[model samples]
Target: MSALPRLSTIFLAAITTLVAVLLYSPLFVPIVSSFFTISHGNVDWSSPTLSTYVTLAENHDILAALRTTLIVGVCTVILSVVSGTLLALYYHGRRSGRSILQFIIFLPFLMPPIISGLALLIFFREIGLERSLLTVVIGHTVFVLAIVYRTVLMRLQSMSRTLVEASYDLGATGWQTFWRIILPNLSSAMVGGAILAFALSFDETMITILVTGTQSTLPVRLWAMMRLGFSPDINALVALILMFTVLLCVLAARFLIPRQVATERT
Candidate 1:
């Protein structure tokens, strides 16, 4: 029995390590290569330099794409959070058709990205809507909205009704109770959803490609550059984006975990 347990632990540990490597190797390759140069198609691992980072700064085309991505991310975050929160709030107290309506709202997220992209492309054409950054933002929001909505709705459902009842017993108005009691508790959930939405928006490519007109986000721009071959500075850009994405994930964990623990303890 002891040998069996020990062997299982070893197996699990090995599998975990293998999975981590498989997941992160692609990310690490670009980050590691950003500080080194290639000679005759071989990376010069013996020497590392900041030349790639410097060149990345001066690359106007990539910089513009990065800026566009940021703009789209911020806009997507705002639109997703507001719409999601409102929908979550609306559904929470309603007795009718919430499940059906939620299914409709989540269709974009639940369907394959290719399907969603093609559907949106057709919808835009039917409406005579020209593709642009606006369309990109719309696509991102649609894709990420279900995540934000579910996050907020889950938090709302988990909240104790006693808190709101107590606020009402103290003669607080509906708006006052929400502002002071409910919104405060939902704040962490909202923030986590926003971070997730922003991350998805930043990395979105398939939907953006179908919706965008000429001006492209970073991922779309990178895809186009692939045909012409990548610049060395692209490695540096990938490194920076990886670091930023990790930071956002860390921040989201920080905001979300404590609230979950508190709720569990309560």
Candidate 2:
């Protein structure tokens, strides 16, 4: 029995390692090339330099795209968080039509990105809303709204009812209880959801491509640039984005883990 268990564990570990390598190997090339020069389609590992990063700073088009992506991401985060939180709160307080409303809210997120993008495209055209950064922001917000709603809703569900009751018992008004007790508890979940929303928006390509105007976000610009092979500065940009993505993951974990631990303790 012990030998069988050991063999199973080893098999699982091997499979996990293989999956991780397969998923991450492609990213490794860009990160490594970001540090060195690529000559004749091969990396020259000797004499690594920061010239590529300097070039990235001077690439006006890429910088503009990066700025646009950041702007869209921030706008998406704000809209998604506020709207999702409101939806979550509203659903939490009501029982009638909750299931249908939730399904509606989640429909776009659950659909294929292409399908969602196409739907949004048609909707915008029907309404005569020109595609622009605003449309991209709306697209991203719709795509990420479900995540924020689910996060905040879960947090709301996990919250202790006793806290709310105690506030009422102390003669606190509805607004006072929400402001003093509920919002504070939901803060971590909101932050985590905002981070997730921003991350998704930053990397979003299909929806942005469909809804974009003259300006494009980073991922869309990168996709367009793929026909003309990537430069060293592109590699540097990828490396920086990878680092930023890792930092967001770390921050998400930092906020989410403590809430889980505290919930478990309570």
Candidate 3:
């Protein structure tokens, strides 16, 4: 490569590293502080301990909120993966009306969260549905449906149809073909979609704040505590949540990278 191109690459790399540090500074601070003592709004680097995690464990309210977050995440994952997969499979081919319907399905995710949340809130109230964890799950599923749908749909599109034809030529029933051939091929996409849905639900705040009732998810609970300033345990919670989210991403990558990428590349 020319010197100019090499220099440009180095400059771009430096800028990217700087941006990454700036973006992750908040996350880094909390994680580092989680292992240390905090006093008078400053982290004490002298004493490193797991006391904050212990405090986090003893915090009933935070624990309940975390439980609620997990519950919402799991429900949202299940609903999103199933609905998204079905939609992807059903609409894999183009039809005039299907494009409009797919657009509507993605509207919640395409719009701002505030708008989506307000719309859902009003719709729920108009239908005599109360704000609760179920509402939160619905809101999260709606918000994340676009991501899941797109992921599964792309996988479906990239899939070769020869397998299906061969299955039928072998005298397999529709259900058998779907169960044995299609489902296995789409499994990784479903897993990836589920992970993305759960991650979104785990960290969701604005929609959860609007549509949730008395019981709040972890993000909402953390938002509520902002006025009082968070304790050291909040740092512990952040560190843990960050770790868990990273783990989910790793698993998703593992599932989707092998056969899924091959399908797309082909």
**Residue pairs in candidate 1 whose N, alpha carbon or C atoms collide under 3 angstroms:** none
Show model 1 residue runs off by greater than 4 Å.
1-4, 259-266
lDDT per residue (tens digit) for residues 113-217 in model 2 = 999999999999999999999999999999999999999999899888898999999999999999999999999989998998888889998989999999999
Q: Which residue runs does candidate 2 get wrong by more than 4 Å? A: 1-4, 259-266
Q: Which structure among the candidates has the greatest lDDT?
A: 2
Error of 3 at 83 (Å): 1.0
Candidate 3 Cα misplacement greater than 4 A, ranges: 1-4, 259-266
Candidate 1 vs candidate 2: the lDDT winner is 2
How do the residues 1-266 of candidate 3 rate in per-residue lDDT, one tens digit apiece? Answer: 46578879999999999999999898888899999998887778888999999998998999999899999999999999999988888887556688787898899988999999999999999999999999999999999998899888877887888989999999999999999999988899889889988888899899999999999899888877776876788888889999999999888777767664667688
C-alpha positional error of residue 43 in candidate 2 after TM-score superposition, expressed in Å: 1.4
Q: Summing lDDT over every window of 10 consecutive residues in candidate 2, give the lowest-scoring window.
A: 253-262
Q: Across residues 1-266, which tens digit of lDDT does each residue of candidate 1 receive?
A: 46678879899889999999999899999999999997788999898999999988887888999999999999999999999999999999899998898999899998999899999999999999999889889999999999999999998998888999999999999999999998988899999999988988998899999989988888888888777997888888889988988988888777666656577787
Worst 10 residues of 1 by lDDT: 253-262
lDDT of 1 at 201: 90
Best by TM-score: 2
